[model samples]
Target: MFQESGVMNSEVVGKRRKAELVFQFRSSLYFVTGNLSVNKDMTEENTLV
Candidate 1:
């Protein structure tokens, strides 16, 4: 039925949106972690001298 198809489509769209949001969150986390690590490394080098 047409109604069933519409429901299925909406569900697919919702899933896609959720996946996109999760991916964005994960990417931001990776960026933050990398930045923190770089800063730590720089600080350690400065202290060594």
Candidate 2:
């Protein structure tokens, strides 16, 4: 029935939201790691100087 379909739709939306959140989390981690590596290189150069 219509009510069942509505419930199913909301469940699908929830799953989609979760997937989006996971994607965002992965991208954030990647960005942070990238920044950390760059900072490490800078720190090393500073130490040498």
lDDT of each: 1.00, 1.00
- Model 2: per-residue Cα lDDT over 1-49, one tens digit each: 9999999999999999999999999999999999999999999999999
| Model 1 score (lDDT) | 1.00
TM-score for all models, in order of appearance: 0.90, 0.88
Return model 2's CA RMSD, one decimal.
0.9
| Model 1 residue 31 CA deviation in Å | 0.5
User: Best candidate, TM-score-wise?
Assistant: 1
After superposition, which runs of candidate 2 have C-alpha atoms over 4 Å from their true positions?
Answer: none
Instruction: Give lDDT tens digits, candidate 1, residues 1-49.
Output: 9999999999999999999999999999999999999999999999998
* Cand. 1 TM to true fold: 0.90
TM-score of predicted structure 2: 0.88
**CA lDDT, candidate 2, residue 23:** 100
